[model samples]
Target: MGPSSQSATVTASLDQLETVAAQLFPAWLPGAEGIATTAGGGLAAVRSLAIAHAAGTAQYSPFLVDLAVGALAGAGPNTRRHPPEMRAAGLARVIAAALGRPGCALLLRPPDDLDENEALALVRAAQWLVDHGRLAVWISSGSPAPGDLLPEAGIARPAGTTAAGRPGPKVHSTVRGTVRCGRTTDDHYPGERQPGKSRRAGRHGKPHPASRTETLLEAALATRPWAVGRAWNHTLSPGPLVNPVRVDLLWKRERCVVELDGDDHRSAGKYADDRQRDVLLQLDGYAVLRFTNAQVHDDIENVLALLQQFLATRRRTRKGH
Candidate 1:
């Protein structure tokens, strides 16, 4: 009932945790990439948060456990109730399962009925994992009171917005485990088979440099100050609707996606898949634009012009909304 001694300890809401999670992955965090919280249960929330954090990549597998449930059920016979120490140990085992894999982070949600002592036990378990340095832990709670062991983290804010206009409370300090965004390069693309300067197989088998088309398109995209991210072979969604297909280019801030069609795209299956992806992206509220590799090389000026107009319109639309 008294004021908690741990009140000054920082706590991150689900929103803050989501921002931190998004930055950890190599995908764009803006636009539809934001995590959506479910209305159902904490398990749903944790899973959704993990998906959003992974940014449509197969990089993360979120493991969820309710400590309170495990404590009540008891891990061993002859005991129906687990003490805080036992509960913490149970949580540790669960956390260990998520470790040893690259790019994997754990999202742990405490049981709803946890008391102060139990919550602290859970916090200690999470802290121990964080200190180990292999796995990252995100604690999700529907309503976290002060003194909960949620350490403060800096949430990425929308650019140029003042504090008063910003939604939710503001934390000026930088987040503890924030990952900064970098320019997307060819090496970062997942599953890119060719490495630096390897020649094999056929006339086209050499690890060639950037094509003229790719160069022109990247140059044009670079001129646009409004586009926060311009990534090739950018994976859109690793979820059920669209997975395994990578976008030719992505503009995160404007939510505009562009795909450069090559000879392969004209085939029956590829064309159909392209159309399906466009439709799915449109339904997800992104503006989809398609251009040919020829268009990129031959008529790049016009292509840039078109993208400029689209980016402007999208920005205005976002501001209006």
Candidate 2:
């Protein structure tokens, strides 16, 4: 395929993947109101064992518990000594962390050699996660039948893409750094303009205007001598299977991230997503600094001073280590 065709294909596949994800997870829906509760007193969740080729390739089932525990407690011994409930809770927490919300759908791919008893165990485990952890568990296609143990959910795998290989929307690199899917180059730091290159256009071919608050902060940072080596709208991937997040500003050498929050961030969903992003970034050893739009607009000088302090602190800490 030609470059444009390949890009278009990838974009379409990503859209399809998102559609599947949204169908499975209510929280992923646009304007979703937190985690929904069912009339029967259960958390609104997807409990079916989804049978699909993508699930088999993803292989998140076997190490689900381990990944969860490791994420929470750091690298350590096996969690075999932990109770089943504890393990389930840990798994749920990690999955929630990865997806940025509790009760988000989880796709599990059972091992190829899974027996009927093992399949039953998997179903029971998924049930525990749904009941106690409030997670939507989708067991991927192709496991041995567990005898009516789980409600069936169908997921049509996208052609030529495995679950693991599914692409997200393209993130384009700027003169200074890469911009993730949701942001545009007009959001780039004010002072980092590339020589002879026009301002990068947004998806609609017009520049996405930066918020006044962002522009004010960017302008101030541009004049500050200490604000060197910062990249705006940079992407950071926390770990495997997790979507990359774009920070408003990043100083990679100092492992510092700054987020400029607008009114949209006050929503319950965005608040939860921000918290999750912060947790993941912290786990990856980056210090996250969050500033609201009002803060930057009203107290530009103080914001700059505080940011300088934090950046300096991070640099010192890194040097000390």
Candidate 3:
């Protein structure tokens, strides 16, 4: 296929993925709290977790945690000395940091070589999280199967269909980015690119792969003279006391911020957080224009036109003042 055709195919696949995610996530997560088990294994399990983590709903904030790396993986012989309760506590802290809100749900992927004792420990840890932390946990279907270890009551076998066939390269690549094993002391998850790093730079300073939405928007903006001086992923602090906010696109001189939100923003907690951030930006005399990732994927021309109009108006308004 030609380059344009390949791009179009990827965009269509992403749209379909988003639609499937919207339908399946609500049934899998149900509400803001409790533990459960989802049906499916292998790529299906990965797809479900990836979509849930990437596109959350109004009721729950979902995160994908792999038990193969970081502290959680210490359940092996090396860390067998630590009690399961202590291990559970460590897991809980990681979850709390990743979700950082009520109605948090974890889609856990157990290691493939999980033994009976390790399975039991995870089951106990999951129960502890649900009881003490009020977290909703879903152990995705894997090698050992979470159902065999978990209590019947904790098993939530929701019936839903996921997107068939393999996802495009772009969607497949997001799996690693969406899953979290642990967090650093700075509150950023391991492997997350820190702010102030050039957008073009990936780990080891390699050229970063831009998302389809980002690439399209950047191309559109490049042709427009007025779009110059804008920044991508710029950090702004409204005040010293308040924490700094990183914006997707910023025109500092015009005081205009454009945010491209993913499906996760539709979740109740995320929606509230976005509103709060917008308020802080507004208070600091900046206009915030928000767009969904899907919107940018579907209609780049419309997005660019709206952005042009907004920037022009902002320029005139600032000049008048």
Candidate 4:
């Protein structure tokens, strides 16, 4: 075959592979009897049976071998192979889709002839998919070990039941909880009034405790700027009737607050709310500093410098006053 013809053949095979994966993913690996038991015995059932038949006929299934080779091929004059980074990204998106819907499945076969870096990238992507749970991965030829890929991720092909011995639920449940820090109950902030011990006893009591992000900011301050335990809770003026807003990280002495903006803050409504909060803080004679997770993770030094600079200015202003 000419180079053009070979490339077209490879691309066509990949299209077939994608179609097969889409068809078989929803049914999972229920055997022949299970397929019949399912409503309609559907397209997925037929595809699954076809794949099984193809696999048993040959040691290396020609049906999927071409697709796997094409997936691992490097960029060439007439090749449709995706770059390593792009391949990993595409796989991640597929895995996410599979996870979002129950009974969705995918099979990735990496060619054994891949270079070290290519193999490593594929392995990492596979590892990530398996780590997220529910998604079962099978590495037929180029696997590091027989079952090592599945063991660490607690994933097994043709999974009869979930790790907990129950049928896999469609949606994964997430539990959110608060992390309490500091010493024993006696170790309270200087101004923070304990529930019953404080002289200023009232129905409302002190504002909500500092969040985990605030706790980290406090620790970071202790290392730099030397502002340890300086954060104080300052409730929004005219006070909220319900679930009153409170600054995340505050330095009462300097009248500076640091707000850790998370992913939710990027939403239009939340972004507007954030701007309002900043305006309120500014109007209340306080400097509000905002930092996103990316800034903290990617540019820690700069974030710390900005915070330090804000604190210094606030402190100097307080001293001048």
Candidate 5:
């Protein structure tokens, strides 16, 4: 048996935390590949686990801290396969936990009555969590949230921190080197072009404009300045389709198009739709290219290079046009 000393205080630093997770993660995550980013994980991960717990998931294994932060940060990895609602719910729970609140069921399904400050506090907290992703905590995978995982007794915010008068029942998220919520500040968050949401799936928080296309475009942006998507335009002679016909990727002036050929694109139903769309757009003189998902993933760099060549050719063509 290990030393059984009731008096021994065991403190966990970020280093200690990473060590524990490194040993535990591999066993828990079977067939885990590549380098583990756990050493860099921090508060965002911690906030997420609390969220997973509150979401009534007894098994936190399914919802790691990194996954939660990814969802919050709009950075998806393999975790995207999970339902978006799960991510949303996890984010919600994390915010509630940050405020020293338990039983987040109440926040989502609040009691019949809640005061003005209580309601405002809730909104401010969610905004804070979403905007300022726990950048200080480096681990890109999973880490613990700051403060008590479960707040003990009466809630607390930093002393003399409240700007809008006396503190309410809500616990504020105190980010190091970041402006605290439920207070006044001139601080603007990172991401000059970050999207904001009014509400999430059955959860009270701001969601972003992140969709499947946004994610794909974001991934593409890392390498290439151009990405193709099914976009709509009303400037055509026939005034475009009834809705946006999937154009894959369209380089306007240079006139290029790219397609993501998933199984859906091969199936008769989807293929027919795609062919009709492609035919119409092609008739409009758009230079089209196609690639499979495997091709994109297997060699993104090569694919991006091809696109750069296309863009260059198109630039010349546009000059002629």
Candidate 6:
């Protein structure tokens, strides 16, 4: 994709490639941007990296592949909102190899009925970068979710906190790929849309363990319009509740909670406890939507649309009240 870190003396070699492509590669390299430079800076940068990477002169790392493919992700007539399609695209072998497993996938994914193929892939890939270490993702046309198939293979996200006291953005750096938090995170940077922007459900923490279903419902309330498109990754709590609810997707602005009801919620013993919890949530004025693993895969759009209509009706009723 962009730069080859796998080559010997990656930094030094990249430096030489940069010199050759001075007018090309350096322009967008932060300091290079806005500053004056020689002609063909961008082209030269791409050319140098491409040539070196193409030849054995540079060690071809996934980093380079990701850089190249990502450039297409943003620009090019072929650039896309959903990356998996672009990834599955039968283009350069480097793109295929760059779009490798684990790196370009998410441990958790959004609903199955995703709209834009490339964007979905990008979201999945970005989430992977956050959960695991950032790796290179090559551009294929539409292939998505290698991570789901290879959860054991991802690079574990480096251990540290951001300046904000949470896992900071830029968990890893890339030569070409532009990385940021997924559309699903609670805290979006400037200009990024925050759907649950109004509701003050104390968004600082993740879902509570015993109360995961409760907190996730609150979070889903914020992402109502695109609930089905939302997700959760970072761990907010770790408790006795095995396989706790990790994310809550909003179908509409309705206060509905769609949890990945596993054995914990289905088993006969835990059924009573789950019902009691649901009763309490209703007392708090939440609808508390529930879905099984089968529901998510078999009838996603139907369930999501139904939930949206349900929420819409509920909102109307609340206002009327």
Residue-wise C-alpha lDDT for candidate 2, range 131-209, written one tens digit per residue: 4433433343331111111111111221223336743222111111100112223334344223333333222211124
Please provide, for model 1 over 1-321, each residue's C-alpha lDDT reduced to its tens digit, 9 standing for 90 to 100: 111222211122222322332223212222223333323453344444445644554232332122211212232121114333332232333322222212223344344455555555545444543333223344434322111221222223222212255333221212322111111233222232222322122112111134445556666667778555556656567235345545666776666666554454445555444544543454344555666555566667766766676666666666877
TM-score of each: 0.35, 0.38, 0.37, 0.32, 0.29, 0.26
- Model 3 residue 125 CA deviation (Å) reads 38
Best by lDDT: 2
- Residues 4-106, candidate 5: write the lDDT tens digits: 1211101111112222223333232222332244344444444544355535643244555554344334343424454443433443334434344442211
Worst 10 residues of 5 by lDDT: 135-144
Instruction: Give candidate 1's whole-model lDDT.
Output: 0.39
Candidates in order have lDDT scores of: 0.39, 0.43, 0.42, 0.39, 0.34, 0.32
- Higher-scoring candidate on TM-score, 3 or 6: 3
- TM-score result, candidate 1: 0.35
Worst 10 residues of 1 by lDDT: 1-10
Error of 3 at 54 (Å): 37
Instruction: Find the 10 residues in a row with the least total lDDT in model 4.
Output: 172-181
The sequence of per-residue lDDT tens digits that candidate 3 reaches over residues 1-321 is 112232232233223323323323223332312222332343344435534643543222222222211112222222223343333333333333333322333333444454444444544444443444333433432211222222221232222222354322111111111111111223222333333322222222111134445556777788999788777767789655568887767888877777655544545555545655654565455666666555566666766766776667666655777
Count of residue pairs whose backbone atoms collide, per candidate: 1, 2, 1, 1, 11, 41
True lDDT of residue 275, candidate 6: 39
- The lowest-lDDT stretch of 10 consecutive residues in candidate 3 is 171-180
**TM-score of decoy 5:** 0.29
RMSD of each: 19.2, 19.3, 21.5, 20.5, 24.4, 19.5
Residue-wise lDDT of candidate 4 within 1-321, one digit each (tens)?
A: 111232332333233323333333433232433433233644445455546644654212333232222222321221124433332233333323334332222334344364544444443443443333223333334212212211222223332222355422111111100000122233234433333333221112222344344455455666864565364354545123223457656666666566655454545555445544543344334545566655555556666765565566555545766
